[model samples]
Target chain A: MKIKADTTVCIGAGMCALTLPEVFDQSEDEGTVVLLRETAPEGQEEAVRRAVTLCPSGAISAS
Target chain B: MSDLTLPMTRQRPFDPPDEAAELRQRASMHRLTYADGHVGWLVTGYAEARAVLAHPGFSNLAEKMHPPIPSRLDLVEERSRRGVPRGFFLRTDPPEHTRYRKLLTGQFTVRRMKALEPRIHEITNSCLDDMEAAGGPADLVEAFALPIPSLVICELLGVPYEDRGQFQEDSKLLVNLETKADDVIAALGRVTAYLHGLIQRKRKEPADDLLSGLIEGGELDDEELTGVGFLLLVAGHETTANMLGLGTYALLTNPDQLAAMRDDPSVVDNGVEELLRYLSIIHLGPFRVATEDVEIAGNLIKEGEMVGVHVPVANRDPSRFPDGDRLDLARPTGGHLAFGHGIHQCLGQQLARAEMRIAYPALLRRLPGLRLAVTPEEVPMRSDMTIYGVHRLPVTW
Candidate 1:
């Protein structure tokens, strides 16, 4: 399954981008939050879940 | 326990019932000493909760005492020696509180709150977009809950929103008891010092924001201006951070409530109110010392005894909110103590409400089927902390 990130919740602690750079990136201007994935990679479902689960702000989710 | 003198009897800063049942089972209230024998009262009943909060006998200034301009004051002596005002009005009574509060009031008027709705919506949507593109289950706290208000409050105050990441780190240290008091105090000194500079700049170039307006008016002294800015940042960020975590936890756990809001977007307003009341994340508010000997709920409080009005209990009081346990979107009241009451009520409440109202509906609609990826039992809750919330609220749609 693919997902879209909930960026408003991002404190830009930069943990998600650090953990999964391929799928997530921090915004250059605001250092707010940015997501490279319009949808998750086919085999990366568990890793994506880990990114969501580990978020301290509870900002991200999957659809 | 010994009848220890309240080393810091000072001024600072809710409840109810089937509340009777809940009160009976409440996380037992105790009159304990904090950080060196500061004697304060703790009330858990909903009715008395409001009464104590609104009570006049309580004092807010900690470093100052009555009659005993002794060689040493209590909790606040060091801070005052360093020239910090007794503390934020979150610890004050009117008319002094009135003076400090007035400088910041124009920012929280209902009309002002109403105006922020659109901007709050803009911030909320931006955050929702970031979360959506991440793909799969994610920690709602790190990803969405914390930043939404960080963006909203920073924008409202005209602080660089991006700086929150670093400010948040310093904030954690500032609020952490385990951190060296000196280091934490130093962090606070830095944040306030920076805010003072920002307020100075705002005076020269007024923006259409609260900080600039407050600074340009020249009503708040440099000390109060510094203090207010810090309060806004700490209170602004800390409380809402918990609200986002706990509110989402409530929704994710209560599938029916989630579905109801999902089906009808308009319910978001009431849902937000109920969540604020129910969660009441900022559990222990400012400590108020008894300036004069006073009595609360039949207990004779001696002069200089420390006490605080716990909000979760007050907001949950049955008199103020009947059927308090159920999270009803339809119910409304005189107000929720969640933002607090009277002169010292939260100045940033409107901003907090605006952020929640916008965030919840946008989140629900965009991620229509949002649900907990983990069972409620598996999810970690922050029981040890005074603010009731989870470390993370893992969700998926």
Candidate 2:
């Protein structure tokens, strides 16, 4: 399992695409995080590492 | 040695200021005084208010912070005069608050607040059908928590719902802590001259909302689109109409969490994240200014000192909410800073959690014997403002 977000430490605060929308999504023109899956899918890796610890701007990262 | 001043007021209208939970149980930073008496630092735990709101060496400019009232230094001298765009980047910090929070974070997304959840369930059933045709003992903070986020932030900032009674009397004299600081800088310069005449009528008629899609995209100018439409019309309807009037007075004074959220309407999205973590209503939480020297949670923050944080004692920090003063609508209420934490967090926090999950289960399943017309010690509480909440709730079925 490996994932990433860091759209330059995303401040969109979308809370990692509103809590793991199948491995994050956003950016309808700069709302930030849009990493839609770098790995986690089968059994959604603990809901993409709990949406990377509910990203209050740590800008997600799973490994 | 007794001057802790900054918003440790409540004295229990739903808790949180037992001198900020006894100064976050005596550690997570302390020394306080401001209101211009100039003594700083306050934090109050939840990991020192998320390490001074995710420190970029803590600084949100206004002369490196500290006026948590002293009429917020007349709203920082009425947003420092010429052109007024600083009134809210939650008071600017990063790279000029990273270009007006990247153009208001694509106008608040979580798929645009879940496609504004069916127009927030048809504006919460037409404000519970105007509180059931104004019959039973109403005043639910003026017919349903100030017109359901003031008609969904005046239809998401196109404004003109008959100019919402002069922008709700210029956002109630710019948030009423007994007004006067030159009448809150003349009611925030009459909401910045009514958002600079609605951004010059959305640049000569460009409607279809969010200030005509920020004037059909030219990357903001007219004083940064009237300072992002006066900070989304006063932080999008005064913090979700004071979190739907103090989360319906803490669920009509917690009658079994309002009959377990009106008999499990799937606990209305963990009962709106446990009523935004047990009504942590925006209480005096954003101020910082260490911009050169810092060291959090184990003290020593110097360079031009001042910090405030406090958000209802860091969202009731019982070491980050394990039974943090109980309001458990099925607990694990995710990391509550109640729409604040890092990078000036709370760009309409998912449209204020989709207007409190569609206005608290449609005002508890359309007033199924709603209850509370007074007597939770006669309601009142906006603890002389700066946003605590419950200026008038008064309900009934």
Candidate 3:
């Protein structure tokens, strides 16, 4: 799986941070998406996918 | 009708003094039980706490609270009949609760929370900026916690922000457990009256807020609207408000955790989760009455018993949450009891989580050099109330 983030559309609800802390982070100043990694690192895909499913805004997806 | 088939009534006293942690300990630890003339069987053990929360036998519909809430309603025998909808979302069991919940379920989805993210950050930063301008001594509760969510819920519910002060006071007094229970009831009535005013305005000229949306959509009747509105205003504002204040206090004192989060903002997510689990404010949370005689964890709870669901206790339950007793951000907390479980679980949870996830990191990053203005021991804390929050969290950069 590959991890891709669309920070432009991310509203920063921060569930990605909650679920997939390794691959995604939030800019605290304005709660914007801050990607930790663009690719699914090792076994982090499942977590990234969970983040995508849990993203309320449909702002993220895992390929 | 009180026959051999149904056991007699029981009452359990769960409130404790000074230390809330110890109170939960006592509730879960001892065979502590109390019996009153009217109120049914009360369950106090950790196992029983979960049982009470999830038990279908427990009825939220029992009209008259045998003991009565306070003096004015003393002879009232029963609490009160459902003047509003028979079962509004929070006051209903599975199917009804589930049905009513569906109305607002999509509202808290991650996408919805994301849309509100900018608003939350704006609320927090602007409040902090005001605090900064006000100089050293300001109550974090008043300046930050109270406003951010108050403003957010107002924006969401379509409350005119300028009129928030009066309604905010209503919300505050309504939640004060020390206030005479009757006065709280009166305050609730005032709030409903206020909501009626808002409903009228929404009826006249529809706006983009939740109230207007609900009204124009005709999704709920006036009574349902009042109940939902009241719940949202009080639950939406005070609960998160308390968390923000208490959470700030928690993080500020836990230097290791503070430094860890500051070092890597990524920790904010887990840090907020742990903070939420560790310092849940609604200690008198999720009250329920047993509908029928039921057995839980080897104990038989007689029909009509009342029980208070303690989230903090459940969160600290070792059986469910490993190393549950301690506040460890590193602990694998897949599910925490912070927002609760079942149909009645907090509706505003996603929004709450979004605010905290934003507030904690921003506060830390904004004042990376921030330090407690007073010792943790000296710092003001509120343990006496149902809502756990510091009176004032004094800090400086």
Q: Which candidate number maximizes DockQ? A: 2
- Flag regions of model 3 displaced more than 4 Å: A1-63, B1-48, B62-78, B81-88, B374-380
lDDT for B228 in candidate 3 is: 78
lDDT of 1 at A63: 67
- Counted clashes in each candidate structure: 59, 0, 14
lDDT of 2 by residue, B1-397 (tens): 3387775567778777776787788787788878767787778788778877877887776655556667676655554443245536666766777877887787788998888889878878988897798778887878878787878888888887777787687786777766766776677777778888878877898878887887788877777777668877877778888888888788877888888877787888877887887778776657777867888756788888888877777777887787688788888787788877788788888888888877887788778788887678888888776677887887788
- Which lDDT tens digits does candidate 3 get at residues B1-397? 1211111111211112224345445555222222234433333344556555555676554352343233324322323543333324566665565445555654565556778998888888998789778776656777777788888988998888898877778776755545665666677778888988888878999988778877876767887887778778878877888888887777676788877766777677777778877776664445566667777766666666655555665666666666665667666665565665433556687788888888877777777766667776666656535566776777777
Residue B175 error, candidate 3, Å: 1.5
In candidate 2 chain B, what residue range of length 10 has the lowest lDDT sum? B78-87
**Residues B143-187 of candidate 1: C-alpha lDDT, one tens digit per residue:** 888888777778877898766766787776655434554675678
Docking class of 2: acceptable
Of 1 and 2, the candidate ahead on lDDT is 2
Model 3 C-alpha RMSD vs. true structure (Å) is: 8.3
Interface RMSD of 2: 7.3
What's model 1's lDDT at B301?
78
Q: Which rank order by DockQ, best down to worst?
A: 2, 3, 1
